[model samples]
Target: MPEAYWLYEDGIGEARATLIDDDRILAARIELPGRLRVGTVARARLTEFQLATLDTGEQVMLDRRPPGVTLGSAITVEVVREAIPEPGRAKRARGRMTDATPATGPNLLARITATGVPVRTLRAHEPDLLEQAGWSEVLDEALFGEIAFAGGALRMSPTPAMTLFDVDGDGPLDVLAERAAVAVAHAIRRHGIGGSIGVDFPSVTGKATRQAVAAAIDAHLALPFERTAVNGFGFMQIVRPRPRASLPELLRDDLAAASTRAALRQIERVPATAPNRHRLSGPVGACLDAHPDWLDELVRRTGRTPIFNA
Candidate 1:
């Protein structure tokens, strides 16, 4: 199988795929799976200048400019032509497959201090994932700890793109909204969730309720999330981190959680209200759903009548 690698040179980024032989570059670039080829190269226009020392032990002038590099700009530099890496060589030089571990797995680490809440930390395994989603430095900051629920509770409900929050005065909903919103931001930062999030505040039947929710949400996000005016419907639409999986999905495997083992004796004994039930029962139903087989095959495996659930 061919493998693609990113190439960065002369301030230009290109994706190069090593052919199956891992020797010659494929020239007939129509399209290939998992491959990146140069589509278009745009040059960046140079402006202001900076003086720097080069590898030749000589001072050199370099270009520094605002709106510097665009889709196409030729950066003048020496080009060294070399063949692709051999399969053996490439195998020996590959970077870490997953990322380096820092502390633990996919959960938060925290310790409370006497003078207010001290600080919280993440397990070591979260850094690479956070970095991949553009949240490396953000996690390092102390501001993240402020977003945890402080003398309050937070409610989270899942949505397709973003999770929705309803702030009831249950326990400082405003502050909870801010904290949960920040957690959502971090979730989005850790995973990429992009779209709209709706935050419903309890009907405050008074002025300033909508603005308060909006301000709280705004303060929690590390990135820009635009909002429309509160609609007549009395629901505030919040734009927070739109990430791939909510925190729960990232934490557990659905398949393992769904599996339940039951012995045939236990399954055959479940109470059935039918007048003359001679077919499959509760445990059999589970087995049929999970592992379907021919009717004869099923009978051979577990000599029990297959009861179809109405």
Candidate 2:
């Protein structure tokens, strides 16, 4: 099968590149805010035991501290966990100070290019291809957690402790469970879901049938994960390492926030001679309205007041 890649930039400093196998998106690399992505080295100051703040204003929890390190002492640390944004709180990272320097190499785009895969910039084709791929629906599903397959559906709910998947649908129990297993695997990878996950498949009576479902999961899913066999109660548990927040967690709770930021970025890109009229979605307009300071800053920077339409 031929592989292709699509790179998209929101023109607002955010970028994402997706790897496509034929028409299906197999994986994606997204750029997130903050400098504390996995494998990045940063200078930090210890504020408390095993906890320190980075120069980027992100707090970090250290796995191990250097010998003789004192409070408020500057030290170099490698990021083991990317910053996860939470509502009404500061984003924090997890890392440890080691003697090794951070390794630098090809990024996702460059590595894909080295493979000679056909890569397309989606800046121009974004509207058409994104719609055709049902990208918005995919985003919605990742955020809201309802996924439909041919024979069944999976409901995902992420919590502080673990992420849960409940499978339900019509058709033969064996077939439905098999299909649901495959779908669950895809959803887990596509949404960047990690950490502990539980899938409640439709219970199958025979041992052979449950084994078949497990085989299907093994065949369809990728590596670097540990999972339990499906039990008689139709429950399977999976554990994947999570270095960062899933894409849904990054975008879901703050879509309006992202939209407002995108709008401001678009405004900055607009030519000074262009008309001051700008259109915004209802939610985006409300978000901007809630922050008059942002609008005032935009006016001060662009020297043009924008007329917003909901």
Candidate 3:
């Protein structure tokens, strides 16, 4: 399948770059502000022996503070894990303070283009082919619980420990299980869902059919993940490495917060002469209105107060 990149700006300071393989979104990169991402090198003040929060408000948990470092002392740290945003809490990372700075690597977009994939920037008004191909709906479905396939539906729930997927429908047990397996794998990849995952597939009697379900998972999902075969109770466990927040965590944990942040990002990208207008949904508008400091910052940065329509 031919691969292409879709770079999107939602016109309120938020931008996302999605890599699509034919119709499926293989990966997505979202711009997050005020957080330290993996590979970021910066000087940080040690708040405690093993924890230091950066100037960007991202807290980093270190293996050990530098030998001579004391609380409130400045130390250089390299981010090993990006911050994962959680509800009503600050994003946190895992890193270490070291004396030497490591070489910085290419960013997400640069790395994608380095592989010779074609990239296309999408404006807010432009039509996205990937969205037309059901990828957008998939993202929405992921945010909610109902991810519908042709014959069945997958309900995904993320807990504090792991993500759970429950499959259901009226189709043949084996057929529905196979389809749900593929859908579960797709959801895992599309949402960047990582860590431990449990899938409750429809019960299939034959051992070969159960193995086939596991094979479907292997065929559709990406690598670097280990999964157990379907057991007698029709349950499978998968372990995947998580380096950042999943899409569901970003969008569903706090929809209003996410939309408000996106609006701020859009305002930053507005051209000086372009009227500086923004239209937001009712909830997002309320979120922005509740925070006068953000509006003040927007005005200060752009020199033009945006005309907001709710």
Candidate 4:
């Protein structure tokens, strides 16, 4: 197995943790300030049941309503998935009743340490390891959800029902399907995507070819996921443990927030001695001002207060 390590950067608006294997980013994680994270155990009241179905396509209306759980009752719960922001209405986060003690969930770095991976923390004064590894390229893939591979690319669309991938390219039919399957797997890891995922691959005839497509995903993606075989129509669905919002979800849901984080990252890269070291404008400046803590952190790292026209 190739040795893997995590390059962690504590940024202003977010803290990023990336898994590096063979000198490339194998996976990425981003955590925003004060968000209710996955694995967070806390006492909560049993609110109204959601009208939506679970990622597994199972009806959850009466499922979470087991023996002792009653509506409007106090119950200890653990967050399973964060709230999904749709066009107009947002989907409330999904949670399940838990018996564990109430405690704050692990942060990005904490989660990486829990996996026993060696980590090298990056300081602002130190060399830009993440940038050298194509951080902007990865974020672009997540923000746009168009990820290119050898023969083709996968267009990832995050819907309220599930995240969908459309594999479009030109190549040998069987080879394209197999390659798309692997590319989808890598995109899932690279973007920290989880929950219900669907991939529509090009039609393939032979059963072995279909199996090969599925095998490619199994070989590339790590375990802790359940998937259905490639069906007759060349569609496969995967369900993974979605404890929090994925990287794509974070970037696509809010343009201003994403811009704010990007602005902060840019400011961090400038030398403190520069005349315009901490300058921001437009939505990024306004968004940054709303979050005093993040702005304070930016100053703490760069040693300069921001100049903005918010």
Top candidate, metric lDDT: 4
Segments of candidate 3 deviating more than 4 angstroms: 1-3, 8-11, 55-57, 64-74, 88-91, 102-108, 114-116, 128-130, 259-282, 290-310
Q: Estimate the TM-score of every prediction.
A: 0.30, 0.80, 0.78, 0.86
| Backbone clashes, each candidate | 17, 0, 4, 0
lDDT of each: 0.32, 0.74, 0.75, 0.79
- What is candidate 4's TM-score against the reference? 0.86
Better of 1 and 4 by lDDT: 4
Model 2 stretches with alpha carbons more than 4 Å out: 65-68, 86-91, 100-118, 125-127, 258-282, 289-306
Clashing pairs in 3: 12-265, 12-266, 13-265, 13-266
Q: How accurate is candidate 3 locally (lDDT)?
A: 0.75
1-310: candidate 3 lDDT, tens digit per residue = 3455554433343446666767667665555554556677777789988998766665789867567777998777888777666656745688877676644434555655676777775553345454565555655665687888879889998776788999989868999999999989888877788888999998799899999999999999989999999999999999998877777776776778676876576566667778766888999888887877778877776777788877
Give the lowest summed-lDDT range of ten residues in model 1.
Answer: 7-16
Model 1 TM-score is 0.30
lDDT by residue (tens digit), candidate 4, 242-275: 7677788888888888888888887778776776
lDDT tens per residue, model 2, 21-134: 667666554554434567777777898879877776768789866569899998777788777655565357788886666453244456456767777665431244543555
lDDT of 3 at 113: 65
| Cα shift from native, residue 251, model 3 (Å) | 0.8
